[model samples]
Target: MIVLLGITLAVVILVVVTWMLLTRRLREKYAALWLVIALAVLVLGIFPQLLETLTGIFGVQVPANLLFSMAIVLLLGVSLHLSWELSQAEDEIRRAAEEVAILRAQVERIERAISSGKASGVEDADGVG
Candidate 1:
């Protein structure tokens, strides 16, 4: 039983590593998860008894694969939500920048008008003297 488990785990790891390499999906962001999956598989491969003991300690009755799948799904959903928020923020920033430009133009025009008006105003020549 242990030998069979080891062989199965070895095959799974090889397949996963090959897939990641081929797809170029070995980014640092997902590195931890990959490492965890790798380590878990390795441990399970080399020591099925140990894995059983650990599972018993943790009171985890569900299959490891099912738990891993759920985690991946949750991570994907959170990532998508974050991406959506970032996109919304980007749009808001663009609009704010446009508004700032408009206000800056208005201010410049106002300053120019004020300066011209001041220049054109002649204090009564006597008063100026």
Candidate 2:
């Protein structure tokens, strides 16, 4: 019964993630990661004996402990990845802001030159004055 529930939950998650990916709401990189996680859940749910084998191999006293450990590890990995992505985004935003500031200054200087030329009726090589 519990196995069936787990499988159902995994399937639901998989479907939702797929929908998000198809709608462009989720990036391909994140979709792929989520798909992998969902597939893992589905597999473990279908064959719970695998979890028991893993627990025995790891010398865990209880299967719940193994589950909790796996959950913690997965959460930590996801958190780390998100943090790295945020850092990269922050750097890119900072660079773009700096570029915009430089461009704005240049634009202001050009406007000042044009306005000053007009006020003094300066003529260029073309002599249009």
TM-score of each: 0.48, 0.94
Residue 34 lDDT (model 1): 60
Q: Estimate the TM-score for candidate 1.
A: 0.48
Angstrom error of the Cα, residue 43, model 1: value is 26
How would you encode candidate 1's per-residue C-alpha lDDT over 35-122 as one tens digit per residue? 5666666766777677567666767785575546656986797689669978999999999999999999999998997677669884
Q: What's the distance in Å from true for residue 78, model 1?
A: 0.4
- By summed lDDT, the worst window of 10 consecutive residues in model 1 runs over 27-36
lDDT (Cα atoms) of all candidates against the true structure: 0.71, 0.95
Regions of model 2 farther than 4 Å from truth: 123-129
| Reference-based TM-score, model 2 | 0.94
- Please give the distance, in angstroms, between residue 78's alpha carbon in candidate 2 and its true position after superposition: 0.5
lDDT of 2 by residue, 57-123 (tens): 9999999899999999999999999999999999999999999999999999999998899789998
